[model samples]
Target: YKAESGEIFAVNPICTHMKCDVKWNTSEKSWDCPCHGGRFDCKGKVLTGPPAQDLEVVNLEQLIEKDNS
Candidate 1:
């Protein structure tokens, strides 16, 4: 998030187009595509792409709990 103050906004770790890894793009301030030409902003809105849809977000705490057992 473009924090007015210090902040943390969480999102999914997977790409919407493919199962590629996403990294924090410091210069552009967004998640970048490594496999396809997909681009998603901090809040997970599709900025550019073959995948013209936002990445799916999952609740981290719930997902971790589900995976554990």
Candidate 2:
């Protein structure tokens, strides 16, 4: 996610609770799990849970360069 200060953070698209795939919520600017109402912020911190842990953060530098090329 992009912050107002132009910092970017990324997280895996999976929910920590049940391993369900998470969808991006543009309105909330968070990752939401349809299965169990788990929510995570852009930096992978848990916003709401059944999830006792945060999502995994991914390093996208390589993928960004590859996509640009």
Candidate 3:
């Protein structure tokens, strides 16, 4: 997600709880799991869980480089 401050936040979209996909909550500005109600902040920190671990942070620079290549 891109903040108004011009910072970018990215994470693996899979929920740690049951491997279900997470969806972005625009009103809440969080990643929310449909399966078990797990919630994560923009930086991928666990806000609420069935998940104890935070989502893995994706490397944006590496991804950009790979896409360019």
Candidate 4:
């Protein structure tokens, strides 16, 4: 996710709770899992439980390089 200050944060879109897919919560600016109500901040830090572990952070530079290959 890109913050208002122009900082970028990338994380795995899977919830650590039950391996469910996480969707963006625009109003809250967080990632929310519909299956278990797990919420995470833009940096993938757990904001609410059902999820105790933070999401895996993805390297933005690696992603960009891979996309260009």
lDDT of 4 at 38: 92
User: What lDDT score is found at residue 37 in candidate 3?
Assistant: 95
* TM-score to native of every candidate shown: 0.70, 0.78, 0.93, 0.89
Q: Is candidate 2 or candidate 3 better by TM-score?
A: 3
Best by TM-score: 3
Model 4: per-residue Cα lDDT over 1-69, one tens digit each: 899999999999999989999999989999999998999999999999989999999999998999999
Per-residue lDDT of candidate 1, residues 1-69 (tens digit): 445566556678588777787777888988888888688887778888877668776566787799999
Clash pairs (backbone) in predicted model 3: none
Find the 10 residues in a row with the least total lDDT in model 2: 58-67
* Clash pairs for candidate 2: none
C-alpha displacement of 66 in model 2, angstroms?
Answer: 9.2
Error of 3 at 54 (Å): 0.5
lDDT of 3 by residue, 1-69 (tens): 999999999999998879999999999999999999999999999999789999999999999999999
lDDT of 4: 0.95
Higher-TM-score candidate of 3 and 4: 3
Quote the lDDT for 24 in model 1: 71
6-38 in candidate 2: lDDT tens per residue? 998888888989999999898999989999999
lDDT of each: 0.77, 0.90, 0.95, 0.95
RMSD of each: 3.4, 2.4, 0.9, 1.2
